[model samples]
Target: MDPVLIMADDDSDHKIERRRGPSTSTLSFSGIIAVAGLLASGVATYNAVQNDIASLKRGELYQERTNERLSEELKSVRIEQRETMKEFNEKLDRIIDQWARGRKQ
Candidate 1:
């Protein structure tokens, strides 16, 4: 193979030196660093996802509790309304009966 020629200085004496690139060890080390960075990024993403899931679960639980409280409130209101209607009906019946008796006399 022909050696690479490089001009060192602008002089009468010309020197030829082979061109050198990055060594194997340097390339391997750089590759390892890149892989490590990728792994770290993946771990960060996973942790973020887990945190989001936990937040969602907490929100769901809060909503469920709120729904239960509202349901209880609704049930109490219904019971109170039913009682009021029963009392009103009883009063109306008594009034009607009293009127009928008065008319008979």
Candidate 2:
């Protein structure tokens, strides 16, 4: 009895190797880039919010200073008006008293 033998010789027959699937490294690199892009966008949004808050604070401070100045001006104007009215009333009273004395004489 003789045993059957099988042998493969290089360049004698064409054999195709089936690929399993896509490479893991390619998918991993794509995922990493996506995460990095998301993180960068979040940082940019946070910085923009901070700058807006700072600007709002500055606007409020400016408004407060303007209100203080207006209040002081209003106080000064009231004082001047009171002084003018008092002087006018005193002069009218003196004129009326003199007229009454002349009538008696």
Best by lDDT: 1
TM-scores, in order shown? Answer: 0.68, 0.65
Give the alpha-carbon lDDT of every model.
Answer: 0.92, 0.90
Which tens-of-lDDT digit does each residue in 45-95 have in candidate 2? 999999999999999999999999999999999999999999999999999
Superposition error at 69 for model 1 (Å): 1.1
Q: Against the correct fold, how does model 1 do in TM-score? A: 0.68
lDDT of 2 at 41: 100
Error of 1 at 75 (Å): 1.4
* Model 1 stretches astray by more than 4 angstroms: 1-19, 98-105
Residue 90's lDDT in candidate 1 = 100
Q: How well does model 2 score by local distance difference test?
A: 0.90
| lDDT value, residue 48 of candidate 1 | 100
lDDT of 1 by residue, 1-104 (tens): 32333333334376557899999999999999999999999999999999999999999999999999999999999999999999999999999999999999
